[model samples]
Target: MINIQSGIPGFDQLTVSELTEGGIPEKSTTLIYGPPKTGKSIFCNQFTYNGLSNQEPCLYVSTDQGYKQVQRDMTDFQWLIQNYIQNQTIYFIDGISHLSGGKFENKNNIVSSSVSNPADLMVKVGIGTRNVYKTSNHFRSILDSLNTLFAFNPDQMVIKILKAYLRRITEAGGTGLIAYTEGITDPKTENELKSLFNNTIRLDGQHIHIKSDHPDFDEVQYFESTYTITDNGIVVNENNFKNIN
Candidate 1:
């Protein structure tokens, strides 16, 4: 299995390359769940930026905010998505535009399409994913916040569609990250949603806990570390998180 570097030095060190190469395993989907303001979005930004820097095509499906805001945030961190946008290496599914009655417009060379409804999200993402694959079969993607869809649709429906969509991405040889709001669902519901991914990252303030499975390991492996989000992205004090179980 191939692994793509996560771009954050601390994440690479904390997870260790032996297990998953200190990065996200290629063609696998990872779930990122945490409370609000816990750096989940920043984590997604860093991952997306890493893919762009590596010339990997990326698809960002935004349900909680506009693609413009995401670009603005990446700019504030100096990640720079403009070049990628120009080159068409990055695509976005703006799930907010239709909700606002089409007030949003595609600016510059930004490649984006709006979803008409929650169910249409799958179609929008498929379009973005196919477009990215045109540049490279190996790509990266992120769906920002599943909670918004859950608000309008049934939890089971969201999970079922998300499972199918994530499976399609992986089958097409793409790695994906999904951001989900914690505490919005019961334990059973949360676990059920998390079950759809190959790996899970749970964030608590500056602390992060990761759960992953390796073919060589009989059981799942768990790791945790504290980190700070900086202008350069996530910063982990490599010394603080050596205990891996």
Candidate 2:
């Protein structure tokens, strides 16, 4: 009853009753790992939308997509992307400039940053997170993808940046989600990330798996679901996926 509802379609349903009763734990970091086109980004968007609906301060760091594209995609799903953008409750830290290589534009609740540089990313996240912390009592954030970060920096450097970012979120006692593309990063490298993040969700094609390694986790902490990623969002059709439990 006290857990943070994912607000993701069928995610809670796929998990058993305990998860729905408890929801996603606060101050927890979740990794949404999957192959290319596995719906990780849409899940992040839905999670942010859910936070906005709950009036929770939200931060969206676009590491892979441009601001305009993100807005357009969210609009297609009928989310009022601009309303939240204008309200200042949900902020977007633009990482597109790092990819597009243009002038940075910082506006109301919109932070433009050079995420290509590891040091700049750390500083930008620090500043943006601090600003959100100062104003909002509780907030949720999504770092769109670790793939871009890993692509730009060496494995060791990316790990350091990730560690710092996670620490900031934990210190703020906020919930966070960081997604990564599976397969591209070697198992040994990803294990380093898995060791740091408590909750792991893997999407291999249509199959879905979720495991929680939180301190309070019990044997029943694992679950699965079958879902389809569509233009709207992820659609969960059944409670049990593959009966892997």
Candidate 3:
């Protein structure tokens, strides 16, 4: 049985046993939640790149940044860019524009101009829409940012998109990591989405918490890892967490 491990080197020393014990549950979905600048995206990138290095194709659907920007950011991590990112084992889909519903410049003109033909308007709307469809059928993992979707519509509509996305990934026999910002504070909404995931990881400053749905596993565990932004990537120093039981 292949063990699911965090891509970070020393960090795996903290989570290897648990992940190897039950094989990290096949088709598992995890949510990494944290406030802004709390290393959520970095963590997502690590997982995606790790899967790629393992010869597992990974998809990174970005709702916040463009393809070029993401590439530029990853350049800081030499290993990431040279080993996996540049090798095309990892794919990127920019969905940031979709989160805005439609382009503001295009919508303004349509609204300002007295175009009475609803059909024409519908066509124009469709033309302005941005849809990102995956080309590859086999992907071992997908990392998507939920913050953009929530910014688009805070209603139940976002939930529908999330469910569809998750279903697509799992149906393809791949694991996925969906990230949500800590801004959404409604417990009911959080729980509703949480039920869809097999695992949930929370990041707060330097603290990391993992929660699993399986009863036999440690449902809740904490790690005192220093979340540092380095040139190579986001490094997690788990040596300080002696009480990680």
Candidate 4:
């Protein structure tokens, strides 16, 4: 049986099975990169929310959408994360607020940063995640999209920052996911990110593709599946998903 499952229906049963045999390996990081409107945010939400529901401490680092907007998105999708926030099972790091003229937050589980590189954002995440580790031995984290940071910092600088923080997660024995916005960061850099993360997946319309050269994954595995954004929460054709190479 898969030990750690992606909350998405077809996902855990297929690609993760194809890639890792088991579910996403613990103490690892996966990159979910793609253009907008392709359910990237929902994918991350589903992962973190699943961990939270399992009584595992979860940390959400929002670089693109602020925590409130993520909350709204989860609400629209009917995942309902507010209770997790209320009980502190889930901690949040908001990186978009200060850039948008909002004040910084340092108190409570919901912390805010000044919208900077992973160095600054990492500090906020480190603080919140450290707290989560106080009582829990395992956790899952997500940096919604690093594309926001890439827009300002040099790709090399951004890459170094991500490498350092991801190493931190590995040392702490937690799984992480960092999303990438399609077509914004250069293709060369994107390829570098694919190499760095080792496990990378692409979200395109109703099609999800996995691209990697690792021995564990072959070339571009694509899956045809559908999803909903309403109170239907999330729906996936788990049993009928078609895998096309």
For residues 1-245, what per-residue lDDT tens digits would candidate 4 score against the true structure? 22466777666666543545535657667899777878788888888878887887787888887888999888776778888888888888888887888766565898877456457777776777687777476888888888788877788988888887788766776788888888877789878887887567777765566543343445544544555443444456565566665
lDDT of 1 by residue, 94-151 (tens): 8776677656666433434433365567876677778888889999988898878788
What candidate 3 gets wrong by more than 4 Å, as runs, is 18-26, 79-88, 97-138, 215-226, 242-245
> After best superposition, candidate 4 residue 3: deviation in angstroms?
3.6
**Candidate 1 displacement at residue 183 in angstroms:** 1.2
Model 1 bad stretches (over 4 Å) = 106-116, 214-217
CA shift at 27, candidate 2, in angstroms?
1.3
- Per-model TM-score, in order, reads 0.92, 0.91, 0.72, 0.85
TM-score of 2: 0.91
Top-lDDT structure, candidate number: 1
> How does model 4 fare in lDDT?
0.73
Off by over 4 Å in 4: 16-22, 211-234, 239-245
Error of 1 at 165 (Å): 1.4
Cα lDDT of model 3 by residue, 163-199, tens digit: 7666766666567777888867477887888888877
Error of 4 at 31 (Å): 0.5
lDDT of 2 at 241: 52
Which has the better TM-score: candidate 1, or candidate 2? 1
